[model samples]
Target chain A: MRASRPGMSRALVRRETIAGYLFLLPSLFFFLVFVIYPMFMCIYTSFFDSNMGKDAVDMFIGLGNYKELFQDKIFLGALKNTAIIVLVSVPTVCAFSLWVSSAIYNMKPVFTSAFRCIFYLPVVTGSVAVTVVWKWMYNNYYGIFNYLGKSVGLIDSNINWLGDPKYALWCIILILFTTSVGQPIVLYVSALGNVDQTLVEAAEVDGATKTQVFWKIKWAQIMPTTLYILIITTINSFQCFALIQLLTSGGPSHSTDTVMYYIYYTAFKLYRYGYGNAMGVVLMVIIAILSAIQYKLGQTDS
Target chain B: MTTKKSALYKIIAFVLVLILALLFTFPLYWILTGSFKTQKEINSTSPAWWPSEWTMKNYENLMGKMKAPLWEVSVPFSQYFTEDGTATVVSAGPQVPGAIRWMLNTIWMAVAAMLLTCLTSALAGYALAKKRFIGRTLIFTLIVCAMALPKQVILIPLIREMSSLKLYNTISAVIYPIVGWPFGVFLIKQFAEGIPGEIIEAARIDGAGEVKTFTTVAYPMIKPGVGALAIFTFINSWNDYFMQLIMLSSTKNLTISLGIAKMQAENSTDYGLIMAGAAFAAVPIITVFLIFQKYFTKGITMGAVKG
Candidate 1:
């Protein structure tokens, strides 16, 4: 643990390097084999026209998949749907969790944890389980939504919630919102707890209103947490696959098609490996850009 | 005057959150209740909020659909010893429901993932935190960047790689990718950084080797972080539907979540049967989350701090 002299010792450096790599070997093996290797292949395979099964050839078709991706209406539609999901879910998840956290963060510890667990139930309940139950609730014939809507005179007839394009995407969004709030709520609660209490007390002593104190003092302190929440929520919403695949299968005229679901459908169902890889590359780039922008904004605000 | 108004606002907020909590919990409530409803009750257009006729018919039907051996064990490299070079399989007892088999497979996958990830991440994280070695900064940066990438971005290539390794459609394929992810390594590194340098130096001064020092001193200090990572990985791998769906296709290899999804797809209109499947997939994992809620929360907050 001694500090290095002006002239370093080469043998000590060699010993440290060997020891470090020895410890890193097992984890590095898996990381290199699974993560780094696949990342290279994902980018490499995007230029070829590959398919599943042995007889199918991976023909070199430079820029062909990307060119088609731009012109394909279905791909464009899927992109737009993904955008809608990200836009709708990210802001609402942040705002809703912030509100819920502020309301419960100062309560009794038992009450606070209870509310947190309750909000997190849907997430803890696996997505396939949540989606199937929701599909039943949205059923055309026996759904509770239809029954309650008719009973309250909200609609004259039963609505085909998942079968109609108009309601299908919205239904998907509602389910996504439920599964999306758990971690953000947890983050916000801890962030709010870490806010400077003396500043809030000083503002209160000067007769600042509750709303004023929240915005002026607590808001600035939690901006970084908010930014983290925003990015994770955005990434999660963008990767909303299980719900769509389980509930709608991007059906009812492909109204609920998303980039993640489309990538799965193309790669597995249609066997268009190259095309799917191209979509994946685009999705990754978009997420990287969005996260960068959020990071930058969060820094400026703080 | 201000105190009274603030008190009123607080009351209103409490009421609103209570209502929202009820709404949030309603889906799970519906699932639990609906699983017990009779076919006649479930199909009623009027919708019974509470089941007038509770029955085990749905579960009975589910169990009757498919059956697997009660238990099976296959030894690694058994194929090489066989006359025909085929793997040897050992079975125990009578046949049980496929749901039981899926549950067993899921538990095994989650546990294996947890153990492997914890062991490897602890070793790597300790090294990254304590060792001043060449390329340490680059490796740490790579792990962080890889953690940020959405998992699906690697799915297509992963399938191909699995096939090349002759591991396609196996439980190990799914488990490996889950463990291979770098988030655990990063999380454990954050925890390891808290270990005082003097302790490590003392261990070395006492003639302890690197492995002994890590095992005796470092592991005890970071045990809580490892606990958090274990439960976190378990729940996530159990619920990782996209990976499970892509990597496993055979009925015998399927996880409970995939089993439920398949059932729902086939029996689209049979709400009673599907709810039974959903309940089966959800209950055990939710129980695990409740038991380890504290560690799980810590893992999440820690990840976010670096993220």
Candidate 2:
């Protein structure tokens, strides 16, 4: 960010540089110590046999943990579950939020904000609280789902939604969907409001149908937001842990084990720090590659 | 934009949004109502849409479960300054229910994080946006990239770092990382860029020192961004269960969310008591969010417009 001007002076540049670094010093300190340093350590420790003990000597076993990760059945299962969550959740969340935001963005001001706040309530309520309430709702014998199902003849008997492997992952996905949509909905509504009004009117006057106007005109305009929503939703779906931990603990034969949950289970519970760090590295690389692909797609489309 | 829509289409869309809104609000509604339901109603096969008896029994049980001193006053890095190389932790308040203590701790943590994030980010974001320093481009690039990466990947290493610094099992571990997160810096930088370069120049020509210029001319202008960042950080800090979960393991140090999780673990089938903890944790944060929601929305929206 250098300036080139007829009257620009070396002393002014020096003073500005000093001031800039001084201002950045505090934030840079915290960022380096907490974020950057830990990041390096996460990569560095993945090569070692750093078991749970704090004082234990970490033997360097380069690629050993990564090799073991491929052979571990539970780790592979977790990877599958993590992929399924990302694949299912990201698109659904994006489409559903886009639909909801389009439906309400043009409404009266009060109604628009009211709708937005209502959709975001679950998010504001905090995850732990929301997870607990849903646990009760999905209770096997006395859950509201079963009670209503029986009354309406949707099912003949009680179903253990969380305990049964068949429905457990789906149940976790449903809750994740609810919490995930809030931010995307907020983002989309704002983006929709910013859409070019005259362009929309021109398209309508040119006999363009509503769907054509949306897909061809409005969608391109909001593509950055769409990309943002997609990336964020994907990341969130991959890191889905609190819900699994609280409701199922990845139970019913590891049916709900996400990579994030598995990381916790391995490092903290199984005392395999090196293995956990290996999983963390793989997850990070996957996210980075996906985010890069998304960036490129968003670039080409927009 | 609202022109020439079919009446049926409009009607259907309206009805659908209404239904979805109701569905979305259900969990919070259930949390409130279920907290008041009697144990008999809760255990019944038929779901009670509303409570037959709105009782305070659940709250009583939640409060009775654990007790701790209401406040603990300790310096953050005071250990290095002390005689025995241990921080002086002095508890001065009367014993209160652990739920109440957790709530207080959560509020204190959120407020502290919010203040620190705002101050540090305002200074750094202003510099990045307005100053042409050496390494400015490098620092800005680092921040934008870091903002995209998942934070949990580094938790393993962060745990060790905190332990070595003697800040493990303390609230500062949670607060420092949150303060370090670059989202606020990125956001405030976006806001600060909108400030005209000439205004800063005018202040500089008037012989205002860098700090003086920022405090007087720059700070007031970017106050709204800081306000948004404050509310955003507060709500996030309050709900950040993972960091709180790992850093603060002791019973007395748990945040409200952790308190609820612990309660649920202990009383797995006790719906009434669990609901009480849920209500206690959810209601205050929800209330704060509703009040400052306009700013919070702005924060999220501004944060998305990245470098």
Score residue B294 of candidate 1 by CA lDDT. Answer: 77
TM-score of every candidate = 0.96, 0.96
lDDT of 1 by residue, B8-49 (tens): 988999999999999999999999899999998899999888
Sliding window of 10 residues with minimal summed lDDT for model 1 chain B: B84-93
Give residue B305's lDDT in candidate 1 (0 to 100).
Answer: 78
Candidate 1 CAPRI classification by DockQ: medium
Chain B: TM-scores of all predictions: 0.94, 0.93
TM-score of 2: 0.96
List fnat, each candidate: 0.78, 0.75
**Candidate 1 local lDDT, residue A11:** 85
Candidate 2 regions with alpha-carbon error over 4 angstroms: A3-7, B1-5, B75-86
Positional deviation of residue B90's Cα in model 1 after best superposition, in angstroms: 4.5
Q: Model 1: residues >4 Å from true position, as ranges?
A: A1-8, B78-93
